[model samples]
Target: MNRARALWERVPAPVVDIVLVTVAAMDLWPMLWDDTRLGVALAALGCAALAFRRRFPLGVFLLTLPVALTQPFAIAPLVALFTLAARSRNRPLLAVCVALAAVTSSVPWPLASFSEVGRAMTLIDFVYSLATAVAPVLCGQLLQAHRDLARRLAEVEEAREHERMLHAQAVLARERAQLAREMHDVVSHQVSLIAVQAGAMQVATKDPNAKEAARTIRSLSVTTLDELRTMVTLLRASGGHATELTPQPTLADLHKLVESSGTQAQLSGELPPTVGTPAQRALYRTVQEALTNVRKHAPGATGCVELWQDGDHVGVTVTNSPPTRPSLALPGSQHGLVGLRERADILHGTLEAGPTTEGGYQVRLRIPLSTD
Candidate 1:
């Protein structure tokens, strides 16, 4: 069916016109022999006018009507009426074309000298002509409706494909951000501990403190590997087990985080025990990233990490002194500050980081506990 429709659509307008005109001439040929030769010639010419029916339907109808009156036996007028009804947009014109076809086709019947069989044959001819005239009009309407429906379906499918592409892009972006957060949390925590313990060992080489610092570094490295392994295993798990993968680290681990940084951080706030896990996790990450920056950028700089809760909100701040050596060049990760800002924004929090007037760097974060 689709192949037939495609072939029909591809037919040239001029070729369609030639085919229709040929058919109309053949249908009129037998009837023209019964009429006057001049009348027959004019009727054939009128039928030929139907070659332009699709482009000028009403004009064909008008031209064919006069020729049918001169030789009512001519069948070309009926074909022209059908063309007009099928292709013309004018309703009044289609009504006129249908009435003219029925009246002209019936006129020859009453004037004929006929026996019972002849009369029946004339009636049958009139009926067949009327049917042919109406059928093409109806078929043309149905074809047009089908074309409209197909166009709408194509549009809907295209829109669905575009929406799918956009959804896939959004999912990829979220996964990338999550992976970045995980890497920052793991690497920054471990590297900060290494730097702090190494600095302590450098100052305590002759004292008993060097052994404890060495042990701390070893433990820190081992713990970092275990956590990384757990993360990889969780990623490899499937389906339902994925949700039951690894537990997320939260603010409860903040104390251990500070101790591992090898910085003496004093806690001085009454934190709510019932804070949301995500909020707690974000807060912990904010402090972790800040302290990591300090250890990398300001060696031998003492610092304090503080967290406080007040009626549905949490605040965190980390501050550290300037580097001792003025010419010291700090190690840097360009993404650290950008990632911290993004994390705070996701949690609907605010973050500020900069050098302080007291020759130190400070990072402060504030997050609302409730979405309200």
Candidate 2:
């Protein structure tokens, strides 16, 4: 049924109008052939008027009334009535049209001949014509209802799809909230202990090399704690309105971050002050992650952190030379660079990390300078 309706709808409006006009004209021709010239002209006008039924249904129906008066069962009148009923919502107007059509078709033409017909027979004919007139109106109303139901169903489906998307986001937010709790309770506590122990050792150690190792461990531990706190706060905010996290690192903190990275890294170059806070944070993180990787995977390697601007873009690049000593195997989630890449993407930027030809590793990030 739906496929048939789709096929019917595919027929062009002009073609459909032409077909209706043709059918109406053919139906009226035989009946009006022997009638007066006025009758023939009315028939022609009624059929021609059907061509505009969709645009002016009421006018077409009124014009066809004369044809209905001459020929009680004319096709033009019925088609015009159907078009009006299908398109119009004015119930009172439609009722009046229906009654007018029934009356016009019931009363015999040439009023002087009415006395020759029996009153009872005329009354019966009117009742029958009235009922017949209702069929087209009823069919047209049914079509109008069917179109309304289809539109309502489409709206319901769209609402359901939107609800599903919202539900998925809620589920993700809840998971993030749970993860935030775990990080705050377990990971932060452990890192705090590591930092405290390293601090005590740095003060108490007598060996110069051991003292330096303790200081490095403490510096790395404190940095990790700061980053973990920020992550946990962001995750906690995901379940609802964003809560502002204070003292977020920006470009001003880049030099300090590189210095405390526990690596022999040099910071160079600068970006314009117009860079946005979010972009500054991204740049700071990129350098932080790159230097951390160097300290972990390239022992005895010196690093350089360079900040620069290229046309409308500003970025930072962290490069480390080949490790002088063999590196120990380290356990990691291996998602650091992947997370950085995702952050860059969110800022409409890109992150590229790979080994250099001189056996060094380099991580570079470029993002549009945000004036906001």
For TM-score, the strongest prediction is: 2
Estimate the TM-score of every prediction.
0.49, 0.74
| Cα RMSD (angstroms) for every candidate in the order listed | 14.1, 4.7
For model 1, residues 1-372, the per-residue Cα lDDT tens digits are 889978998999899778877887787776667777777767777878988777777788777875765654555676566666556567676655666675565545335444543667767766775675566566655656665788899999999999998888677656755774676577656666775666567566775666655655655666665666566455434222534556777878888888786444555455677778878887788878877776667766778888887667788888888867553476566888788888879888888999999898999888887733
Clash totals in order:
0, 0
In model 1, the number of clashes is 0
Write down the lDDT of every candidate, Cα atoms only: 0.70, 0.90
Candidate 2 per-residue C-alpha lDDT over 1-372 given as tens digits, one digit per residue, 9 for 90 to 100: 989999999999999999998998888877876899998998889999999999999999999999998885788899999999899888899889889888888888866767777688778878888887888999999999998999999999999999998999899889998999999999999999999999999999999988998998998898789889889988988855558776878889887888788789999998899999889889988988899899889998999999999999999999999999999998778999999999999999999999999998999999998734
> Which residue pairs of candidate 1 clash?
none
By TM-score, how accurate is candidate 2?
0.74
